[model samples]
Target: MVLPAPRYRKPANDLRPALPPAQRSGYTSALASPGPFTEMEKLLAVTAIGPDRAGLVRDLSEVVTRSGCSIHESRMMALGSEFAMLMLVGGNWHAIGKLRERAAELQEATGLTITLRDASARPKVDAVPYLVDVVTLDHEGIVLGLSEFFASRGLEIAEMSTRRYNAPHTGAIMFSVQMTVNVPASVHMASLREEFFAYCDAENLDAVLEPAQR
Candidate 1:
């Protein structure tokens, strides 16, 4: 049986400090600057979520640069109809109000739901045990198929990676995913293996699940 993602999440107890009011102007100025963020610099976290489509990244990049911010750490995921981006940007403008206005403008232009907030709002995620790796050729229904597999078995994915393969001859697209999952003591490892392989066979994708040696 297949199920939707279980809303699996990290513990909420972990906390991060809020961005200081004094850092706003400096952030704005740095974004206006024409360079990458230095070690000593700070960044504003900008997020955008909506239907996945063309030019989402390009449009956001242009809007952010125009507002004087430089993207540093970026994480993006496209799940069917939804697309999400988390960008750590370094700049001198810290006025969230201005950032909010700019995000509104981008939304008007792209029909995207955009948000600008201090990254500190999200809680920190502590390290955990158990990792899952899955490698496969690129195709539709990949993420959802595997996500369902994890959820059905009560596993939570902490992080995952997927990309297209660039082999000169084969030129096959691939997805390499590494995730951390919670294992209940009662679950049988062999049964989980059977389930994983069964799904992989049906989907015509190569997948492997094992205890992380590290």
Candidate 2:
């Protein structure tokens, strides 16, 4: 089964455990503690989701602000009755420490499920870009099939979104997807498109693959 990831994931590199309440309550002497790291900085990516309500943005903003972190980038949207957010926070060691220590408080106070993970740095991706558009009758496994097809060919999906809606004239339910995939330079473009068509044909999917516009 394909399940959504949980909130608050520690990376393999993070070896420390959450501090106990007693340790959390006491700040190791400020005089000895090195404050917000000025020279060394890192990003922590946060994902939050909950029932839609007023002041959602404000509450999340307050959490980040209080933690002494800066919002580097974020996106929030209502998905049906649920509100989802993904944000990148940047700060020095001390600030990130404060964030980790207090994030659970925000989650409890706001009734939102929050998850965090360190985003060390994004490695540059060098590959040819291709855009794929697919439309078909709404049905389960469409996404899984598409993803598996790409994976079989060693393709990397950079961005993808799928939506279900009624057809314009017939009003029949339909699923549509627009995605960007990165093909390694070693792969042949013509043959890849042929393989995509073959898979779509077997799956009764309507699809088009083309070079992505710069």
Candidate 3:
């Protein structure tokens, strides 16, 4: 007797079941259409310093716009008589290249010292955020002391700003500090605060350590 023809079978890896006629057409169309495509962004850290002048921001912004780059985050301030800018810009690779090429022109036209460097996105931190505010008589090593205190505890200072100004009534030169620190989740909040306050007391720094509000 003739042997029966071998039965047809799909390969084990072919797990997807066959679709109906209309469904098959739709599925094929979906596969053919390009889904959402997002271009990978390149980052650049741009810093510029120049004499305080009107239209400085305008000029810098114009260059970025023309280069097809956008400033993602920026800090612009007048430090004494000089204007300083720090920016995190994002764009495509070509856009970033264009921006880099224009840096010299921007420096020459705006009288600013410009610097650019490739930057990566900030990594997420698994820690609690606390705000530290300190006001004391202006003296040497205030920041150094505060930084050392946190550093010893393995805390990270995410952002910090310090300023010196004359007291409104007494005309005394006073220093003020504001900082956002990342405290590890494993740290005991009460103990840390107590130690920080004690240290502040010993150093004559009037300080407030509190949880940062979102």
Candidate 4:
């Protein structure tokens, strides 16, 4: 007797792995399909200095735009006859590579000495922010001394700005500094304040240390 024809069974779809209920719905379209994957955004710290001139910013910005990078933050200033700039640029890996490729051209066109550094995001820190202000007669080693003081205590200086000017009435030249420091949570606030005040007094610096106004 002839055997009955064997039945045809559809093959199982084993291309995709078995996923839990939560991930099953999107498993085919989101994971199985071929699609473009996103690249991690990167950062570059750019610094440039050159003779001050008109349209310098416009020229530099044009270069950045052409390279598909965006300036996240920047500080530009004129020091004497020279212009200096510091910028934090953000872009994808390919965009950053494009910027690097155009660096030489940018430098030649802008007449500026440019430097690019890879700046990765810093890990979050558990600390409190404090602002410190110091003013005193213009003299040497003021910044050095203050830096050493904070360094010795394991403090981080987030930002600082200093300048010199003549007193309004006395016309005496004076130096002033403003800084934001990160104080670790483990440090005793009262003790730190006392020590900071004592150090300021010994250095003849009229100072104030207070919590940073958010």
| Span of ten consecutive residues with least summed lDDT in model 3 | 24-33
- Candidate 1: where are CA atoms >4 Å away? 1-42, 94-97, 120-131, 134-158, 161-177, 180-214
Runs of candidate 2 with Cα error greater than 4 angstroms are 1-39
Backbone Cα, N, C clashes tallied per candidate: 16, 3, 0, 0
| Tens digit of per-residue lDDT, candidate 2, span 1-214 | 1222222322223322233453222222111223343347878999999999999989888888898998876767789999998887888879888888778898998789999999754444556556677777789999999999999888878666677876665677778776678777677666776778888879887776666544
When summed lDDT is taken over every stretch of 10 residues in candidate 4, the lowest stretch is 8-17
**Least accurate 10 contiguous residues by lDDT in model 2:** 24-33
lDDT of each: 0.58, 0.71, 0.73, 0.71
Most TM-score-accurate candidate:
3
Expressed as tens digits, the lDDT of each residue in 14-114 for candidate 3 is: 32223245422222211112222234988888999999999999989888999999987676789999999888788899999999888889898768999
lDDT, candidate 1, 1-214, per-residue tens? 2222222222123111122354222222211123444445555777888898888988888877777766765777787789998777666546344556788988998788776656532232232234454555567888888888888766766445455544335554455554555455456666666767677678866544544332
Report the Cα lDDT for residue 209, model 3.
Answer: 71
- lDDT for position 91 in model 3: 89
What TM-score does candidate 2 reach? 0.73
The C-alpha stretches of model 3 lying farther than 4 A from their native spots are 1-39
lDDT of 4 by residue, 1-214 (tens): 1122222211123111222353222212211122222348788889989999998888777778799998876767788899998887888989999988787688987689989999865555666667676778789999999999999999987766677776665677778776777777788777778788788878888776766544
CA shift at 98, candidate 3, in angstroms?
0.9
